[model samples]
Target: MAEPREIPEGPAHERVTVVLITWQRREEALVAVRRLLELPERPRVIVLDNASTDGTAQALREAHPRDSAGGRRLDVVVLPENQGAVARNTGVASATTPYVAFCDDDTWWDPGSLERAADLFDADERIAVLTARILVEPGGVEDGIVTELRESPVQGAPGLPGPALGSFLAGASVVRRSAFLQVGGFSRRLWLGGEEELLAADLAAAGWELCYVEDLQIHHQASVLRESTRRRRNGIRNTLWFTWLRRPLPAATRRTRDLLRSLPPDRTSALGVLDAVAGLPWLVRERKVLPPHAEARFAALEESQRTSKSRNYSR
Candidate 1:
């Protein structure tokens, strides 16, 4: 593995680094990286390629060649195997900046947003994660999920930029590197879909605050190169795993029952349930219920989550 790139000096470089993960979406990844590089913040970016069969690694290298002076604006790490969301953890581990902004293959931060996020982190030491308002591409309309984030039922502290959040969307959030590492980053077992919740919960439990900042924005094109059914399956399975891993027995049982009732009676749903059940032994061994304060925050968001249009399991 290459050594983590040094955060370039001078006012030209932002104190934030972008950590993007891509798998098989080579074209989208290139577009995202190009857009990120065009930002005024000039943030250093690390791309973690999860063993793409396509020429994503070579394409990235060609697009952002290392400078002959031994300085680079971009660094690409091509893993031998796909590690799913854990690839972001690897990218975060390789970040030298105080803050890391995560973007998916089809997402890019809006210009000046990274600078604003860095300023927010600098202003509040307790703030660990700041989720940006996501706008879909083409027409640049606000994503449905942004409404829930903006109207968060969870209460905010005095210094937060917006409403406090019980969880954050990993694809559009900037996080304090130290706090993320302290919480051990994303869970390897959960892999990819809906993986941010467990880490967000742990951060809250550790006394770090997460908030939604309307001024900051991320653009997501929602790549067509995706496995919708597989994503839905993993998402359902991971949600169950997380509920069992962190919620109290009563909450977990209720959430589990609700999930089962809501899921479609199909092969994908069956497989997800099977996968979740297979992980019960590990969940039983590692279960640590959230603190009352954090649990209350989660409880407040339950209604919103249940009614969310952006969180549907269907393709």
Candidate 2:
């Protein structure tokens, strides 16, 4: 067996577990797991397989037999049905760590990034999610969207360890376990793409702060087969759903109009908008607006949302 990476000693041996959500990308998932296993933090890892039919469960078990038994080991949870973000909730339930770092099947955390994230949570009481700097692969370039996070237009108090973020990138963030359970993990309805926004808003409403940690890093090598068009559709739909679910009526109406006007005059955007409106009956029944202060934060991010290259509704 290969010797594990050297981990930093902290206040005792606090475990930090990693939960990676995977679908059909078996090879990419294996590579990511390999890198994660090499992290200096030596996190207990779990791969949440969302009913993948491509032999992912078999591959994982075959590749890491010893990682499955005795000691603090890697566990693979295979769901019979596709539960989307709820798969993450199951993975979190299975983790025994005070912190859980989420990584996508195609992404990997830096050497000691998980430990640093765990340290931040250990030191702070108010911080719920510590979002990391995401760099794209091979050439190792900064994801352009990261620039927006770094120079976040949202105003926060001086005492904050990092910039206050309106939303988090799930694949590149470390979340405190207790806080995550308190606010509930990602939404089941939002499925995969851009699912973090609604949850972030809810976490803030519950008085937990989400911060951008510059020191921790996660690398994303976007997979070639990712269904980008469908992801775009879901992003648009989920954005609209979030707008209706929590924003005040006037704010929701205005935001909906703005989204409509800004969207391309094509069938895709049309379907996205229509899908959102189609769920209006439930949206109205479940509507719960944020308090004025929380609403203000959402309002403040509107202009950035309008201008961001990351806000595109198309792949």
Candidate 1 structure lDDT: 0.87
State the lDDT of candidate 2 residue by residue for 206-286, as single tens digits.
877888989999999999868776777777888999999999888888888777777877777878778788988988897
lDDT agreement with native, every candidate: 0.87, 0.82
Residue 208 in model 2: lDDT: 76
Per-residue lDDT over 122-223 for candidate 1, one digit per residue giving the tens place of the 0 to 100 score: 777778899999999988999999988999999756768889999999999999898999899999998888899899889888888899999999998988
Q: What is the lDDT of residue 249 in candidate 2?
A: 82
Give the Cα error of residue 195 in candidate 2, in Å: 1.2
Return the TM-score for each candidate structure: 0.95, 0.93
Candidate 1: regions farther than 4 A off: 1-14
**C-alpha lDDT (0 to 100) for residue 308 of candidate 1:** 77
Off by over 4 Å in 2: 1-13, 67-69
Q: What is the C-alpha RMSD of each candidate to the true structure, in Å?
A: 3.9, 5.3
